[model samples]
Target: MSQQKSDYIDEVDVDESWDEHPSRDELEETVENLEDSGFEVEVVEDAEAALAFLQDEIPAESSVMNGHSTTLEEIGFMEYLNEGDHDWENLYGKVFSIDDDQARADARREAQTADYFLGSANAIARTGALVAADLSGSRVGAYPFAAKHLLVVAGVNKVVEDVETARERLHEFAYPFENERAQDAYGVESYPAKELVYRQEGTEGRTTVVLVEETLGY
Candidate 1:
């Protein structure tokens, strides 16, 4: 059985301040700064619009891979990639279908170089930086330069005033909730073992950040 955010969100305690939507001016400035940092920026009304944008943007026959992202699940992208009638090849499905642990690990590493890598950021600074961490490097390995292109889908709640606040949010807010989720889902503890502070994109069209208006993920 799959677990939704609604299933355990209430059981976790996080700073609500980290989840508040920023003002319109703040959001606009963030978008501008993100664009200045060489990232393609798109502000969507909600998760549905974000999903629609992805459906139109990714070309048919492209290889698609994704990290373990609650935001992606909230937006229905994981389900869609696994079950939807899309033309693209879902590399995640292929990688995980292997029965051998070592073979699956190798496949996961190879999948990082897919045509499109999708995931969510734990915190987005108003200065245009993105903050995220994972127990392993699996989730963030594609963000820097592994994949041909990176697509980040995050809610406005992840936005903070600056990089300092972004890191704070990662520790004080995102980590706790994620730890709880990890314990419940996998019966193990999780930590910020591999942290990433993404500041800029060198390639013009290599990265895109889709910011959704509604709060959807941690």
Candidate 2:
């Protein structure tokens, strides 16, 4: 869909602190302020800590459901899990994409049984809102409700100005990643993500977002 055609969405402009991209110093200040807003905050220097937190300390269950994102692979996630620590009796991505029969089964089984869930976020507002666009449903659906605890991991590049820009960034960047995610999760290369995401409107769920300071995938 054309960008303008996608304008019938809720409009929330970030007119307060993040009217523009926060500088390094401003970014720290913003993070501090956001942490004070009743949300748990963890700042990692680079992708290494993010990787360790995701694959090791977060939690390990028989099933670990995740989106088909390149960031996970870039951080040596598959290697880390394949090498050791992660149990071998569970599933990963089954229906998170329109993949073939085995891939579909993998995603469905993982989402059904996984106690620990993780996925990349397109943007993390200073208000601690986790934003994403899910076509295969891995971005937010499984992470927010299916998992015991949700860890929203995003590279520094995903951090944007405010809520409005965050939504804009989804169209600019996330859709493409979703396209790749579709290809990997299935095996087809023509699937593009639909612009529908689930948010925590009236749920008392806890979502942990780890913001990294280096450039990473979408």
Candidate 3:
């Protein structure tokens, strides 16, 4: 069955303008505040630069894993992990390659402990808080503390004025697209059963946010 736009958004109403790109000044302020909140922030020109930055950040032979993220797909990180000349363990690829269902599940859980874990945020508040929701905890489970290092990649369009607006963006924008994707891919509906609101990074250099200038993901 084909997905419909109304299938997701009908559950929660939100302002359509929340999806617009932020101004340069707004992006700059958000970056400063994110840095003050203890998250390493990098502003890339586009998805290509973001992908290149990711390649440089991760070292060879390190075990790497990632949650499902359209931003990462847009940046070609997923394809690179599968087909490129990276020496990292590529834990996600390994987990999916397992044929046994239980073994695959076990591998997925084990992947949370990978040296580097990457994903995208639903919304990033100018106040420096990050918001994301997931149907299963597998993706977000590593964000809090499971993974050794975390990288959250997002587009400038995900930035908002505050935490409240960030929440709105998740419900209005992220949820709808994600729900449709879940149905089409998994033949199941998705919900925000697991939600993450990252207000600060207590450990220095534990997490980094790659904010691309272009509009990239949900």
Best by lDDT: 1
Give the alpha carbon lDDT tens digit for every residue of 111-135 in model 1: 9999999999999999989999999
Clashing pairs in model 1, backbone N/Cα/C closer than 3 A: none
lDDT of 2 by residue, 1-218 (tens): 11211131223332222223446875676466455543455678887888877665455444565655556656666556555566533345234345587767665745743565666676666544556766655445665456766666666666665667778777655555555544545676533354433334233335566777766655
Candidate 2, clashing residue pairs?
93-107, 94-106, 94-107, 95-107, 99-186
The Cα local distance difference test for each model comes to 0.91, 0.56, 0.89
Error of 1 at 137 (Å): 0.7
Better of 1 and 2 by lDDT: 1
**So what's the TM-score on candidate 2?**
0.69
TM-score of each: 0.97, 0.69, 0.93
Better of 1 and 3 by lDDT: 1
**Model 3 CA lDDT for position 171:** 86
Question: How do all the candidates rank in terms of TM-score, highest first?
Answer: 1, 3, 2
Give the lDDT ranking, best first: 1, 3, 2
Q: Write the per-residue lDDT of candidate 3 for residues 1-218, one digit (tens) a residue.
A: 22333445555455667669998899999999999999999999998999999999999999999998888887889989999998899898899999999999899999999999999999999999999989888999999899999999998989999999898889877887898778867999899889999999999999999999987778
